[model samples]
Target chain A: MKMTPKAVVIGSLLVLAAVVFVAVILPYADTNQTVPSEIFRSRVSEEAAGRLIYIQNGCVYCHSQSIRKVDWGLGADRIAQAGDYVEDHPILLGSARTGPDLSQAGGEHPDDWHIAHFINPRYTRPVSIMPAFEFLGMDRVATLTSYVQSLGLKAADRRMERQRFWKQEAIKAYEAGPEANVRWLNENVPQGWRDVPNPYPTTEAGLARGHVIYQNFCLGCHGPVGDGMGPAQPWIYPPPLNFTILKGREVSGGVLYYQIMNGITGTAMPYFKRELESQKIWEVGDYVAVYFINQSDANSEPRGIDAAWEP
Target chain B: MSNPSPTYQTAKGFCLTSAFWMIVGTLMGLIGATELVAPDLTKNIGWLVFGRVRPIHINIVLFGFVTPGLLAAAFYYFPRLLKTELYSERLGVVTVVAWNIALVAVVLTLMLGYTQGREYAELIWPIDVAVIVVFLMVFFNFIMTVKQRTEPVLYVSVWYALAAVILTACTYALGNIVWRPSSGALVGIPDAIILWFYGHNVFGLLLTPLSAGVTYYVIPRSVRAPLYSHTLSLLGFWSLIVVYTHIGTHHLLQVPVPTWLKVIAIVDSVAMVIPVMAFLINIWYTAKGRLGEIHADIGAKFVFTGTIMYFFVSIQGSMMSLPDVQRVTHFNNWVVAHAHIGVLGFAGMIALGGLYYILPKVTGRPLYSRLLADIQYWLVLIVSIGFTVVLTIAGLIQGNGWLNGETVYRILPQIHPYYVTRASLGLILVIGAALGFYNIVRTLFVRSGEAVT
Candidate 1:
């Protein structure tokens, strides 16, 4: 090899050609061989339009679409298969998770919830640091919501169906009266959960901690006053729980914890089990009981577990 | 053989332009880092949003700071090594002017949200054409210069420089999908395959080779010695071109691109160690026992540090391509840290080194302030290392958190401090870039009326 310029250029081109052939051309030619997964389907035109909006907004920077086996512990119901992304152009298996994985985000919330959240994440999650997409406008927000609601494809559609089903029941209970809605909401809690009271005692420090957690995770929809009158209330149906109504009801700390941790399926109340630790959940439940409900069963009998730092 | 009045105006122009853009590019990076710490920091500001600013920072760094700096040295050495004046200094200067104009267009269009929306291939069709034109012009200038050379056997530096320009011209065209001006893409997985092929090569083929060329020329000259092994250097060069090209698919290992393609990408990624070690062995052997000489010359010091960074980044790159390793590291800040090491730590350092090494020769004057150059060097080295540490820790925490089934919001409070630390470190790099720009500008245009060595 005398290292001539002509030789260098020709050799470099050949190397590049080989790579393009193997890595690019070969795969491109075989794209039709990529069979759609069980969950995969062609995007509806609206969803496809929303996908473009998602790309334009660079939402992929903060959210990942693909879930792996490692994500199983992260509440992932299914691991991503390559066939799932057969229809995705630039497959947004995004690089960062500044926000939660949206692989199963379809039907995670109703359109109204997404609209409010897009307007400002703080409206739904007080502590959320996600940038607001209000500038995308209401129409674009609807488009974006559609795309997000289609994240898990067929699986997402099934989830959305459940949400729609519950949405109707919740609206029916809500329109009847506050007493009826409160009774309806508490009826969904199991008797074991309804009977259990808060195990942890209320303290100023505990309340303060609860206050902080509430602001970051719950204040957006629950409102600062625990009245379910947060900014997102306008968009969320069954309009978050107005905790004052539960003051005289049989709403125990355990019931609050169960609902917050497991999330009310088919409603806008998303599960906080992944976002908040157990202690934070207990504390927020106690805060809700003491402040909004005007009752504290925090020191009731049959305490499940004693705090190590308890006096 | 030195002429009484040898003016490298084209090289000087590019050197100045690269320094100026380095400041702008790093500032954009700093803004993006700050936004990460506080997403609402630039709320309602469309142009300054993370999405838009990220591409601007990346495009500017690639085109504005690193490439021009490498080309500046290439222009200077190509003529000297070939025993000829540049085929056309006027054409070279025109290319420099056109290069800066295209860069300005890249920033404006991307900021205004007129992008093709592919990573590394974000430039719209018009700007893509502009980019291809400038690269073609540079290639024409260099190839014509080679034709006019009195020397017969082409040195390794000439070969590397010529290869970089021509190869990039083709890569940019194919990657950007210039043929399809509307979407700039093929539909589905095919587009991702082509886009990444162009993406990784932009670094592997362009920056790697150009930086290597500058290193081969500057290291030996600074120490007043010949290269340790010409055979090893050529081996490294050819091996790099062969191995580096196939490794782009390593990025898609988790994707559904083909199993065979993934195998090739992973295999070739590990195989990169051969060429990487070959280059390192050759350069380190050449600089053996010459640490004092390298340290004395700030340019050689930067280049030397770059070679060390190259070893770390290349090895890390190989390990990250594995399916098991990627399970923990992929789609996270671990890759971000790796990218910083490759682009900023390795390539950016060498680009700066190339500029500094040729400053005196091109200007016919010693640096305006060697102390300032030293400060900038330490600042860049420390901040880049700081970025690697902070981002890697953040990545690990996120990876483990996600593995533990912790929600993304839960990880936010934990990683907030790291983002803050990264932003603070980014400020240091911005300062370093500003200082380097000042030093280069003063060195070129400001005369101290002092004699050189």
Candidate 2:
């Protein structure tokens, strides 16, 4: 093939045409062919507006919208179907997970929790490296929260329902009195969990590590002094748990671990299972028992797992 | 002879402009990297926010730095290889001025947050239109020069340059959705498919071919040898056009894009090996035994290293398209590493090489300081290698951590040091960009040497 301008232009155009056909034209033609999945639905105007805000703020740089089958090990609730993104313009299936996958973020926390976290991630997560979005203003923050809470579409609605039901009960208990609220919070724990003592013994190093973990994961709402009056307290209703209320109470390591692991529904508490490891949860729980609650049961008999580091 | 009407002035203008922008562009990148390490580093500064800075870095690097540098060489060679004066030096200078103005507009508008919010296509419609006009102007000048060519047969370099301009003009217009002018996008998933098609092709069609063209021209001349295989070079060119076009969808494989589109992307991504190898083999064979001579010329040294980086990135790109590999590689710093290798290592290196090769010819002067150029080269090489190592390691940690159900914040502590390292290396690259600008400026306007007639 002698190099000629005509040949080069023609060949380049042909290749472009082929790509446009295969990648763009055909896929666009079949776009309407995608049926909405069970969990897929159109976004309301507010969510759609919030989606624009999310895009503007470049949230997609940190969070991914699509979850895959390979993500099953990551505790993904559902594999993303193409239909799930049918209504998304420029579908923000982000290219980095600098933050957790937000595909199922709806009802992950109350709107108040989201508001406080957005104002400053460090308030909710002391170790968080996510940029503070407080500059988006309170109204824009609320709009962004709406978009985030609607991530899972129809499935997100069900989770939001559970959060709403729990929220009303929690508020009622909180309004009654600290004694009634503590009882209500403890009653949610199973009998087996309430009776189980901390298996790990308390040490200076352990308590120090626990303190760090508490600051990163719990201090936002639980307060620096464990009084449930941290910066986020203003926003979160049924506020964070005051560890002092657990003093002279029948609180055990298992009870604290369960609540931290699963998070309290209808409240601002978020599940720590995704963020903290087994040892971290136990350590933070022990730190709470020893410091704010002025009690310690971590040295009790039948310690759960033998500490390999302990002599 | 009355100074020949400053025949290469347009090329000189673009060369200086490109070098100047490389410094600004790399500094933007450094700031973005610093903010990644400390998100509060630029809190409440909308103009300097990571989101805004990121696009600025990308746009400036693509248009301001790499493209103009390559075009600098193109403007020089188009007249020389065609055995004619440029169609109009006046028109060429006008285009260069317009190009810089458009770049300025790109920066100001993006900083002001008037973006369309699409990755790679973020420029608002007005700047988009300005970009198209500049490309059109270049196409007009070049095509007219080609029409007036005293030489009958067009070289491969001419074809590549012409195609890059005309094709990108069309691609930019279509990709930016110039018709709508408001959203700059189609309504849904279809828009993603088109945007990435344009996105990947911006590199595949524009930078790849331009760099290849400059390499094709510089290597043989620097080594003072004939091309190893003109036939092979043309084959690589055509095959690149065909295969590279369809691989954009590979970025969307995990998403819910059509299955057939994904398959085509993967298949074509692997097929990219053919053209990539063809170009490398031809170039290496041409420089086969003349490596000492190539090293004697600083320009060919950068060009040759770029070719080697091209081989590594191309192979890595093909493998990354696989579903299993992507499970661990996608949505992580691994891809970021890949981008650095492709853009800075491969294309940016060649752009610099192209500028260096043409500088003496255009200015009739040896470089102001060869030592500084050499230092800049090493700095770029070392920093790019450091970036690939640190970012790839961070990516693997993040990918494997996510696979193991570890939380994103938990992985942050593990990768924090790497982020610090990346920012530190970024400082080195910014210094290199500054050194390159200083070297080019002095070589062009300051230094005096024997005049070429």
Poorest stretch of ten by lDDT in candidate 1 chain A: A66-75
TM-scores, one per candidate:
0.95, 0.95
Please report how far candidate 2 places residue A188 from its true position, in Å.
1.1
Task: Write one digit per residue (lDDT tens) for candidate 1, span A1-311.
Answer: 78777788888888778777777777888875677889988889999888888877667767777676667433287877768877676567666777777888888777788888888887887657777787778898899899989988998899899888888998888899988987888899888888888888899999999888887888888888999898899888778888887877788888899999989766678887767878899999998888888997886888656658777
Which residue pairs in candidate 1 have backbone atoms (N, alpha carbon, C) closer than 3 angstroms, thus clashing? A73-B405, A74-B405, A127-A216
**Model 1 misplaced regions, further than 4 Å:** A73-75, A199-209, A277-279, A302-311, B1-4, B447-453
State the C-alpha lDDT per candidate. Answer: 0.86, 0.86
Best by DockQ: 2
Q: Could you report the DockQ of all the candidates, in the order they appear?
A: 0.56, 0.59
Candidate 2 lDDT score at position A133? 81
Colliding residue pairs in candidate 2: none
lDDT of 2 at A195: 85
Best by TM-score: 2
